[model samples]
Target chain A: MKHTLPILIRKEVTQFRRNKVLPRIVVMMPLMLVLVLPLVTQMDVKNISVAFIDHDRSPLTLRMESHLAHSNYFRLCEPVGSFEEAEQMLDDGKVDLVVSIPEHFERHLTLGDPKPILLEANAVNATKGAQGMQYALQTIASAAMEKARGRGAAIGAEQLLTVENRYNPTGNYRHFMLPALMIVLLILVCCFLPLLNIMTEKEHGTIEQINVTPVGRLEFILAKLIPYWLLALVLLAVAMLLAWAVYGLLPAGAAALVFLAAFLFALCISGFAVTIANISDTMQQAIFVMFFFVMFFMLMSGLFTPIDSMPRWAQGITYAFPPRYVIDVFRSVYLKGTLFAELWFDFLMLTLLAVVFNLLATVTYKKQS
Target chain B: MDNIITVSNLTKQFGSFTAVDHITFAVSRGEIFGFLGANGAGKTTAMRMLCGLSKPTSGSGSVAGYDLRTQGEQIKRHIGYMSQRFSLYEDLTVAENMELYGGIYGLSRREVSDRVDQLLTALQFADHRDDLVGSLPLGWKQKLAFMVATVHRPELVFLDEPTGGVDPITRRQFWDLIRAAAAQGTTIFVTTHYMDEAEYCHRISIMVDGQIRALDTPAVLRARYGADTMEQVFYRLAREAKRGD
Candidate 1:
């Protein structure tokens, strides 16, 4: 079995080299994600177009408009003369928000019964709309507070909360996304490569030749997986290099611990891929099965959204996914410099997944059939 | 002569359909045994049982003195199989294919290198050793596949329509290689749809609808059916077959 494994791996490597497109794609995918996706997803809504219509035209109203313009989030467009003109600008998509001051704005403030200013927002994209409204409100509230203090009136004490973001002081999104993207790339190469490799053998009829030989089923599966496993590790290293060069991010924990977790995670995914390949009779069937599982795994893995925010049942399903554990390990290792002792439970689960998946794959693969 | 393969009342059923029904056959050592049948006539199914690839539904068989039931791994080790698909890794080179199969059969590294060298030289494939098998013509690929299958020097080899898509000249050359292997005392069990190729076997069996309808020497079968050729003998039996699929 030892001798056969090297030969089988060599054959796979040769075939992999012969296919000119795959190697390039494997390298390029991670590099593109590292370079491009971070820049795209780092977008914090800024330069939102705002139109102002001041009915009172009072000094306080002018002060509020100036504050809204000076704040980084809003970009003051041409001031409109009437509410109709502001509404027309919004309808034309010229501004994302419209701020209007009512006629009694100064009078109400003088009487100590300040009326609220109307801030209309385009709610087509709900998240953007909500964030824009919050920022606008903060600017208007501060402007009102400054006006009250200038009038020599006793102002109420406001509670101030100072938030210190640990681990990431600057709140760089790449620090969070790069590690997760690395895990995603690892999953793609480790799972899909072996799945397609085995399916190709079946399609080209070489699987029947191997089946008729005295080669053990487990040996054959191992031989097929080891090459992709090694390739995924190599790709991981390249991705790390790209991360450092492009984003200046590196794992804060022991590199060995991160790699150990990656290795186990890769093995588990590869075993799952092999089992899928064993059960599927054709390439299309195998691809469909892989697609279904990978989609589910990625969705429930907390890659894009927080697992805690998901519904209770959906959160329960995330426990069954191997990527969820691996993603946690990656984030912990990369950002927090988490020790192995702190991540022992995740490590144990990954190791267990590896063994169970490989055992199932070996038992289900039938040489005689 | 010692029997290399022996079977009695071997049967295989897929649910209600009997693919190979209560068949019995034997082949002596160093003999060229030809298995002939129409499409879906159960020739391949029966050969799969004898090669230890599939278990018989209810019967007994032995190949190379190993039990077909319990010792399938041993049977596999002692025999080589070349399927109708010409099962060679197309992306691998000719020499690499030989090395892989040689290693699979548990040959030592030195043994694999030496045997691969000798086989490449003998087959005149030395010039194309490093070229991908996919780049080779169909005939050369078939020949290379045959060589790879027998690289470990097994005692018996099963070839399933090895010359299916080759030209007549290449087919003739393939037969010469088979004859040489048989001359070296390696038993050859082959299946073919070409009647002329069936005539080259020392003994042939024509299957019809999962049963062996004729099994004898070519001359004896021709005389018994009063047919001019093995093709007519096959038609005579196949015409009366009741099974459609």
Candidate 2:
């Protein structure tokens, strides 16, 4: 076969540009999400007005008060001299978490007894409350251990199980999210767009016209994938520039590594997208199906959350997700500054996905009889 | 000439829907064979199977001397197919569409340029080469779509309703192109609901309710059915086929 993939890719690019919506989405999507969105939106959760109910007034309870006061996760709002002050603060949407240390908290804890700490959190914002509870637990455990160590019990087994968060210092939500968002956006414009293109041809009768020629299935497939792949890379580069310009954060690893990982991952994305195109009979159906795919991918790929935080079956589902692999490479490069050698497993999964998708598309693409 | 298209008990189904029932036919090389049917009468389904787009649920067939089931890829390489829509990417130029089809078929850059020049010259559309197809009129697009379909000069070309929307003038011009393609030794397998178009074919098969109720030339079908014209012949056969069903 004397097929020239570049010619086909150029033709697809020409077609894509002529399609007004696709070009606009590819160019403007990241800019809207990354820069303009961030300027409009905020991650700052500071100066939260919190209610305090100090029953003990002990030195130890005072220490806990200082921890919440100094922490970015909370602020002291009201002290419930009566039950109504704290209740009013909560009802007015002021305090998010209510901590109740029983009257004998310090006395029991200091006298070799484990103390019960009662805390209530807003159910509407349960995740935030969960994070707050986590922080509170760590803070109390460390403080009690420090006091115990001063009492010369620093060698306690409970003190040894300290939680360490070394990789994502400061736990910036944007840092955690930006890399995963890049993968999701790539899938949307990359896989979803081109697959829609292929399927639309079938629906509109264009593929039948094209098939009458000597066009090889492989060449046709390359034609379908290459243009969108390059467009996706351009989208990637734009997002990369935006990530740095907006967040003041360049990916900490090699540029070549990032590009190659993204390129290979795109094959999987486009390949699966073609199968979706084959299965769907209309552009609306294809787009609707793509929404389901993107939603499931984002949810399962640990884009906005941690995979380890999910149930085991959900974690297992991530193995089937192309974004999971893309996210793996993304975090390794952006967060860990990891080299390609360190991400061989992720690379391998993406390569496998590429092969699997290609195989499925090839199997699905039919011409005449 | 020996038949370039041959079928034996060709069958196709989707779930419980039987589109193409067991049908047998052979089409001679270089002959324009018309597939006539009312809407959803299995003509497109059978045409797709012959072109290698949809597999037969059972039975067997061969096109361009290649067994369809085992050598479909080879068969696809040798045959051209114009779908019912006769659709082309309006966003692409005439030359762009030609080059795209050429490249898709694995033609080299030089080959594409040469074929494009020849096609543009033959179609008398060299000046508007760079203009996108969307700018072209419906008649021009239909003709251009026909030209693109036959650009590879495959051994056989399947035209499925290639003249649906165009005016009678344009439709005649389309048949002239089809005739020219056939004259160049390309066997034409075409489908149409138009009785006049059916009369132009060397032989035609009339499909009704998933069965070929009549398979003969326009003259033969008219004579065999004792009707005045192919139109009357088709109506009678359709009535007969529906009664049989």
Candidate 3:
């Protein structure tokens, strides 16, 4: 038992290296995620088209139009002569938003009875529409405030509420996305490698040879898992380096803590993969089962969205996903410098998942029938 | 001679269908025992039970003096099995496959290397020691599989249709390896569809419908059935049996 595992691991690693395409894919996937995914998902919804119909044509309205045009978030189209033309553009999908300044807009402001500024947003893509509308609102509000302050009217500070975005002061999206991408890459490699490796052996009839031997069941599974586990760690290291070099992001907490989390997470996923392989009789069955579980785990892992924001039942399902804890630990440690003491729940969850998955894999893998 | 394998009323069933109905047999030490059956005739199923790969549905058996019911692990450690698929890791080199099986059988590193070198040289596979088993021709692969199965020097080795799809020349060469192993006092339990190969066995059992219809030496079976060839003997028994092929 002592020496059998090493031999088996060596055999697996040798076979892994011998495969012409799989090793390259395993390494290239993480590199692509670290280098390319962050850039792709870093989109901030810029250059939104806006059409203006200013009836007043006053200096105040003109100033508002210029301010909206100069802002990076909105692309101001040529000033339309009438509201009808602005509405036409909106309906044609040429513009995402329309701002209309009513007649006598500046006169009402001088009398302290300001007329409402009507804004129409094309909400075809709801999130983008909402974001474009918010940008337009901020631009107009700040322009109005500048005009009021220029006239020497006292603007009350009572309604102002100061906001602070701690930890990620700049709200760098890369910092959030890179860690999530790392988790995703790790889960994919760690899970599929062992699943496919074992299934391939079964397909090739090599498993029957191993089954007839005296190799312990746990030893056989561990031997099959350790190669991919170590490969996943290597992938993690490469991804971390690429993240720092390409995105300039690093974990703010102890590097060892990040490694610990990644190792535990890899163990949990690989164990789950082995269990899948054990139950499946063919490569197709294993791949389909793996695909189903991986998709479910990724969606419920809160990698793309927050767990708390999901529906109550959906959030309850998130607790069953092992990657959810890893993602939480990754974000906390990377951005907030959270220590182990504060992250005991995540560590405990990951540890429990690892134990359960590995035990199940070992128990489910039958050497004799 | 001491019996290396003793099976009594061994049976296996899947739901209502019996695959290996209560059949009994014994194999003497260093003897070449041939287990013959048609497709789905329960030869492989019976071999699996004897190899400890599957449990008997009823009755009792022992392999290498280990109880089939409780000492399956011990039984496995003491026996070698080669299935019809030629179960060698194709992705691994010839020497690597040898080392892997040796290591699994709990051999020391030095012992594994020494045995691998000796076997490769003796089998004229020294030049291809580092070549992947997949790159080798089918005949060489089968021969290498046979060698790897007996690398641990087990007291008994089970070969389940080891020559299923090989040429007659290759099959003849394979039987040479089996005979050579038997000469060294390693009991060889083989199954073959080729009647000529069955002729090479010291004793052969023809099974029909999950029951052993004939268990005797080839000469004895031929004389009893009054047939000129083992194929005639097999056909005579199979036709007389009250079962559809």
On TM-score, the leading prediction is: 3
* Model 3 lDDT per residue over B110-184, tens place: 999999998888787799999999999898998999989999999999998888778889888889889989999
Question: Model 1 segments beyond 4 Å from truth?
Answer: A52-67, A81-88, A99-119, A137-166
Writing each residue's lDDT as its tens digit, candidate 3 over A1-369 gives: 688888888888898899999988986898789878888997467889999889888888888998998998899998789888899999999999999999999899778677888999999888788878877887887777788779898766532223456988866778888888999888888898889888988998889899999998888888888877788888888888888888678889987788899999998999899999999999998999999999988878888778888899998888878999999888898899999999999999999999999888988988888
- TM-score (0 to 1) of chain B for each candidate: 0.98, 0.95, 0.97
User: Which segments of candidate 3 are over 4 A away from where they belong?
Assistant: A56-60, A103-115, A148-166, B240-245
Q: Candidates 2 and 3: which is better by TM-score?
A: 3
TM-score of every candidate relative to the true structure: 0.91, 0.83, 0.95
Q: Is the docking of candidate 2 incorrect, acceptable, medium or high quality?
A: medium
Residue pair clashes in candidate 3: none
Q: For residues A264-336, what per-residue lDDT tens digits would candidate 1 score against the true structure?
A: 9998999999999989999999999999999988888887667998999999988878898888988888899
Evaluate every candidate with DockQ and list the scores.
Answer: 0.77, 0.50, 0.87
Fraction of native A-B contacts kept, per candidate:
0.81, 0.78, 0.91
Runs in model 2 lying further than 4 Å from the true structure: A36-44, A53-75, A78-80, A98-120, A132-165, A253-257, A339-342, B13-18, B57-61, B106-127, B208-217, B220-226, B243-245
Candidate 2, position A20, lDDT: 72
lDDT of 2 by residue, A1-369 (tens): 664567767877787778878777677888876766554434444455556687888877888788878887777774678546676666777777677777878898767675677766665766666766666666666666666676785356753347676667766667777777677668877777787778778787777765645567788888878777887788888888888987876778886777888898889878888888877778889888888887888788877668999999989989999888788888889888998888999899989999998899888876553
Highest DockQ, which number? 3
Cα displacement (Å) at residue B94, model 2: 1.9
Clashing pairs in 1: none
Query: Candidate 3: DockQ?
Result: 0.87
Candidate 3's displacement at residue A316, Å, is: 0.6
